[model samples]
Target: MAPSTTLYPRATLKKIVKAHSNRPLTKNVDILVFLNYTLFLQELMKEASIKSKQSGERGISARSVRRVREHCLRKFKG
Candidate 1:
């Protein structure tokens, strides 16, 4: 039989739900899905940026990282 699938990986969805558990209820499932996608992209960008700095290659700008960080903080803050 095929393994069961979820909208997101179990751990990722748990982390997302746990992170937002104390926040206001303005966000719905659709918004949560978007947040998950954005957060994943942000993490990828951050890692790439870090690797680029280490390898002496230009990745995303520091300002862009800062903006994403702040946006995440705002979204997840209780």
Candidate 2:
């Protein structure tokens, strides 16, 4: 199997979670949260790109992202 590479800094994720949570987290928890966050961004970008294309835009815009944000959230809802 190939090695896994992180797109964002693990330290930054740790800091963000640390600030919000009162309890300490294990390293695996940090990795899981990082992975989920990355996946959320990927899904959001894909939806935004499709929205932009439908509107004849060359790139994803903030408006496109805003339009699809709720859809993405609903799809990812647990």
Q: How many backbone clashes does candidate 1 have?
A: 0
| Candidate 1 whole-model C-alpha lDDT, 0 to 1 | 0.62
Candidate 2 residue-wise lDDT, 1-78, digit = tens:
776686677888788888888778887777788667788899999999999999999999999999999999887765
Judging by lDDT against the true structure, name the best candidate: 2
- In candidate 1, which residue ranges exceed 4 Å CA deviation? 1-27, 60-78
Please, what are the lDDT tens digits per residue for candidate 1 over residues 1-78?
776665446556556666877654443555566677787677757765775677675667765566466655665554
**With candidate 1 superimposed using the best TM-score fit, by how many Å does residue 4's alpha carbon deviate from the native?**
36
Worst 10 residues of 1 by lDDT: 22-31
For model 2 the local lDDT of residue 53 reads 100
Please report how far candidate 2 places residue 28 from its true position, in Å: 0.6
